[model samples]
Target: MTVIRINAITVPADSGDELAHRFAARAGAVDGADGFEGFELLKPTDGRDQWLVVTRWRDDAAFQAWLDSPAFAHGHRSESERGGGEAQRPVSSHSEVWSYEIAGGSPA
Candidate 1:
C-alpha cells in the first residue's frame, strides 16, 4: 500500500517565503530515492502559519530506506554543516510529521 508522510512545518508569519525558498533550493533532492513516488509543498491559504511537505512512497520500508540513506542526511544538513559559512536561521519555529495511508479515494 502507498504510504504518505506529511511534514507540518510551523513558521512565523513573516518566514513563509524563506521556508519556500529553502525548499525550492533543494527541490528534486529526493527524486532519485528508491520507491519515491511523489512530493508536494503545500502553502496555507487561510490565517494559519503551518506549511506542509507531503511525500508519497511505495511503502514504509521505502520511506525508512530513504531516511536511513546518506542523501537524506545530506539534504537535511544545514548550510553551515555542509561547509557554507554561518548557519542560516531556521525558518520554521515548529514542525511535525503526520503519517497516513490511502484509506479511500476515487480512481484517478
Candidate 2:
C-alpha cells in the first residue's frame, strides 16, 4: 500500500516565515524524487507559529529510500545552516499510514 507521512512543527514566532520558505524550496527541489507521490505544507491562520508537512510515497521502502538519499540529507543540512531561531526546538509530531484514497487529480 502507499504510505503517507504527516509532520507538524511549531516554530518560534519570529522564525516561522523564513523556515517555511526554506522548507518550501527544499521540498520543491525534491518533488521528482523516486516514488514521491505528493507533498503539502500547511500554515494555520491562528496565532501559533505552526507548520505541517505532509508527504505521500509509493510505499515504506520508497519512503525509506528517500530518507536515505543525498537529496534529503542535503536539504536538512541546508535548513540547519540557516539557523532559524526555533527550528531546532519545534514541537513536532509524525504519523504514518499504509493506505489512503485520493478523491481526485489530473496529470500534471
Candidate 3:
C-alpha cells in the first residue's frame, strides 16, 4: 500500500518564505528517488506561520529508505543549521493508504 506523509512546520513569521524555498529545493533534489511519487508545499493564505508538506511514496518501505538515505539527512542537517523560525520544532504525521483516486488535472 502507498504511504502518505504529512509534515507540518511552524516557521518564523519572518523566515517562512526562505524556509519554504529551501525545503522545496531540497525536495527537488530527490525527485528521482525510487518510489518517490510526488511532493507539495502548502502555504496558508491567511498569512500564518505554518506550512504543510505533503509527500507520496509507493510504499512505506520506500519512504523509510529515503528517510534513511544520506540526501535526506544532509538536507535536514543543512536546514536545521539555517536558524530560521522554531528550528527544532516540527509536527509530523504519517498515514497508511489502501487506495487513492484523483480526477483533477494532476495528482500529487
Candidate 4:
C-alpha cells in the first residue's frame, strides 16, 4: 500500500505566507527523490491558521529512505544551522505528523 505523511502546523497569519514561500522554494527539490509519489501544501480556506504538508510515497520503506536521505538533511539544514530562524518562528503552538496507508481512494 502507498504511504502518506501529513505534517500539520499552526502558525500566525503572517507566518503562513512565509511558510508558503519557503515551501515553494524547497518543494521542487524533493521531486527527484526516490519513491516520491506526490506532494501537496494545503493552506487554510476557512479563515483558519492551520497548514498541512502532505507527501505520498510508494511504501513505508520508501518513506523511511527519504528520512534517511541527504535530501532530507538538505531540506532541513537551514533549520538547525541558525537554531531556527524567522522561517520557523511563527509556529506559535506546535506541529504534528499524521500518517496513513492508502487503503482505498478515488481519483480527482
Best by lDDT: 1
Clashing pairs in 4: none
Q: What stretches of model 1 exceed 4 Å from their correct place?
A: 79-83
Candidate 2 backbone clash number: 0
Per-residue lDDT tens digits of candidate 1, residues 1-108?
899999999988899998888888788899999999999999999989999999999999999999999999988866566786667888898999999999998998
3 versus 4: better TM-score goes to: 4
- Candidates sorted on TM-score, descending: 1, 4, 2, 3
Q: Each prediction's Cα lDDT score?
A: 0.92, 0.69, 0.68, 0.80
Per-residue C-alpha lDDT of model 3 across residues 6-91, encoded as one tens digit per residue: 77676667666676767765667668779988888888779766677777888878888998998776667545565554455443
The TM-score, computed over Cα atoms with residue i paired to residue i, of candidate 4 is: 0.82
| Runs with alpha carbons beyond 4 Å of true place in candidate 2 | 79-108
Which regions in candidate 4 have their CA more than 4 angstroms from the true location?
79-92
Cα error, residue 2 of model 4, in Å, equals 0.9
What tens-digit string does per-residue lDDT give for candidate 2 at 1-108?
A: 557777667666676677677776676766878988888877867886667677888887888898889878767655555565434543233333334445567955
- The lDDT of model 4 is 0.80
Per-residue lDDT of model 4, residues 24-63, tens digit only: 7666777888889999999999988879989999888988
Q: What TM-score would every model get versus the actual structure?
A: 0.93, 0.66, 0.65, 0.82
* Candidates in order: C-alpha RMSD to true structure: 1.3, 5.0, 5.9, 3.3
Q: Which 10 consecutive positions of candidate 2 have the poorest summed lDDT?
A: 90-99
